[model samples]
Target: MQKKMIKKIRKRDTKGLDYVINNYSKKVYYLVDKIIGFYGREEVEECVSDVFYELWENIDQFDEKRGEFSSFIYMKTKYKALDYKRRLEKKEVHKTELEDDITNKITTEHIVLDKESSEEIIEIINNFKEPDKTYFYNRYFMYYKVDDIAVMYKTTRASVENRLYRCRLKIKEMLEGRK
Candidate 1:
């Protein structure tokens, strides 16, 4: 089945693309979702479509002797998903900085917190343990979601969430004691 589709794709028959997408959309989607679940549904759908586009464009590179077409598609989907995630991260960082600058300029008269409290909060965050500190910085400072952190740490989303919850409670207790 894949050989026939490959042949058609090599011949530039559009139906070959259709056949591959129809047959493997779910698998591609699964890979994309696993890699970039922090992205919205539309973004994930766009990534899946980008995977198909990649496969279509690189049809000639698909050597049957190297491996299966399914494997090639899976690899391409994973790479594309990671690439998309990196691009989003870079863009988000710039966007956040720009927004912060604008907000600071607009709110000069309405500072959200005094300098001392902000410094204390930073100290608290810096004092957190290894992976927990990293997780907290990624989730709060860098604005990463639980799913993104899970992928980064190679752990489950539930585990990340539970750890974050416990960390938050601990921080709350510490802050309450300080007051």
Candidate 2:
């Protein structure tokens, strides 16, 4: 039955898709839920649906030489669920970043005079060398608390502040055409 279904689906038969989904959706849903159940029922349902769609799209990658077709489907479902889990984790981190009051205050109070300069300055800081870039961000962008950064980097609090200050000052001078 599995071989017949795979053959029909491989031939682009829609009923074969229905057969596979009917037979396999339970296993797929169980795996997705187990991996990312914390994302809530709605996301779990959506992940199950996406897994089926991916199984259909990637049917050609199945290799009889390697393993059974059901194993292939389950593996794909596992990877898709893991991918969803990673994306959700990143969303939480970004949400935390946005909720940082100091970051918001710095973002508002220091706009670099205009949108274009703001973009350019951001570009410049992103390209700054090594720990300087990280230090600049520790002080300004990420709200790392200078004391905490000094401890983490194994440096004096004043040293952290001064390096960060020089980085900021370079951007300031460049923006003012003083460089």
Each candidate: how many clashes?
0, 0
lDDT of each model, Cα atoms only?
0.80, 0.82
Local lDDT at 144 for model 2: 79
Off by more than 4 A, model 2 = 102-179
For each candidate, C-alpha RMSD in Å? 10.2, 9.6
Q: What value of lDDT does candidate 2 attain over all alpha carbons?
A: 0.82
TM-scores for all candidates? 0.59, 0.60
Off by over 4 Å in 1: 109-179
